[model samples]
Target: MESKIILITGATNGIGKAAAKELAKQGHTVIVHGRNKDKTLRVLEEIKAETGNANIDILLGDLFLLSDVKKMADDVKKKYQKLDVLINNAGGTMGKVREATDEGFEKTIVLNLLSPFLLTQSLLPLLSNAPSARIINVSSEMHKFGGKPFFHDFQLEKNYDSVRAYGLSKLYLIWISRHLSAELKPKNITVNTVHPGVSNTNFGLDADRGFFTNLVGKLLMRFSLTAEQGAASLIYLASSDDVEHVTGLYYGPKKKPAEPSDRYYSIENENRVWGYCSQIVAPYMDT
Candidate 1:
């Protein structure tokens, strides 16, 4: 297999880090994205030493802020001409109390949905530069519990719960991935989402999501898959030849194509989500 240039957001920890290390082991040019400079550098060196592959790099950006997301994309464009695989893996559940970023968008929405949308749009040219590129958005099974959609309440101004916010963000992410897959079909840029299952990672363990929820989360961690186990689907999607032509499909942790919940799906809703994301990131699109 031809080695590819891969970028993975949230590569500092958990499944993202696991995937990065594995990819680096395969001799791919891996760009590890993280918010913390110290942590990102440490992970970059760790991957290099562990995999014995020095083709690893790092990019720093806070996905919660659109400005940072745009700047990160710019940084990538400056460094590499073509990106073969982009894994939008940086996402987490916020605190129980809804918090907004400095840019005034909800934290969960910005990190999980808007940031990936903007980053993908900004990197389209680089992705197109590759003979064929892949876009993997790390969604979750929680999307099924997103409840009903309030088209006008994307920011969750009307109603907000930490889990709901996360679920909705992942759900919307899947919708946008589908929309983008179709739009980029002619460009040979395949797009897909993945449910990494319940992974034993620092994903939501630190979130202030009340007492019982936190307890349950901790208990789940004891029985959950390891980070490496959870990242199997991601590595497969990023490197396997079987899915080279597969686009717009959701993969489960089992490393096979699976059905995403369509309880709240519709063509209209998908288009609406796409339009909303495009509008939110329009200002950063050209910059």
Candidate 2:
């Protein structure tokens, strides 16, 4: 419960917001992140007021934009010499259609997988400076197994489904995280992924399909999990002293190890994914 610096994304609401509040309550210098400036400020204020911990700061940006990601992480680096924890929790289904991001890539995969990989790489200096640090990525059990990301037509130009795209993004995240855990082993920076049980929160609702998702689907998702229930695995990985040295593993609620679906555990398959992502993000990887 030391006053360590921890930066978390998607903190305006839902699981990410819950994590910011819990970490602040525990006395960490929580840096809350969200794209909406007003909502981000509100969340920070609530956390500070509830925890009486004004050490919280806010960093705002769209996770899909690499420039925005760099800017946010760089801004944090300028202010803090050490980053005790990083929760890569910003994510969602980027709609059913395959929309290209500003960076000219599939939106869902880029936001959920590529953005975290890039952001974490960019923040390594700060993370490594801390005596002990952890990177807890919000991965999902859905990553257990699937066909390799279409290496040639990677963004599914042929056929695109929102649910499947989101799941594929999470699957890539686990592989990236597992690879990073190994790469950072010498540096004592534990890299782990968490399956924050499907807690009800706003993820899929948007303009294209607002009425159906917001009125019906969102209620069901919310019913699945109170934010507190969803944030459990994240909190465990972020704050627990028991799993301090645990790395390259998947965690579920109650701090239990998650048995990935049969398809996801293939080291060979994961390695294939690691190579692909690393190549794509190589230009941004300085360290």
- Where does candidate 1 clash, by residue pair? none
TM-score of every model versus the real structure: 0.99, 0.92
Put down candidate 1 lDDT per residue, 1-287, tens digits, no spaces. 88999999999999999999999998899999999999999999999999999899999999999999999999999999999999999999988998999999999999999999999999999999999999999999999987987789999987999988999999999999999999999999999999999999999977999999999989998999999999999999999999999999999998988899999899999999999999999998884
- How would you encode candidate 2's per-residue C-alpha lDDT over 1-287 as one tens digit per residue? 56778889998988999988888888888999999999888888899999999899999899887778878877888888889899999997766557887687788888898889888988999999999899999987666533545655556677566666777888878877988999999999999998887677776766244356446666667568788888988888888898889999988876788866555457777787777777777765555
Best by lDDT: 1
Model 1 TM-score relative to the real fold = 0.99
By summed lDDT, the worst window of 10 consecutive residues in model 1 runs over 143-152
Candidate 2 TM-score to native: 0.92
Q: What C-alpha root-mean-square deviation, in Å, does candidate 1 show against the real structure?
A: 0.7
Alpha-carbon error at 267 in model 1, in Å? 0.5
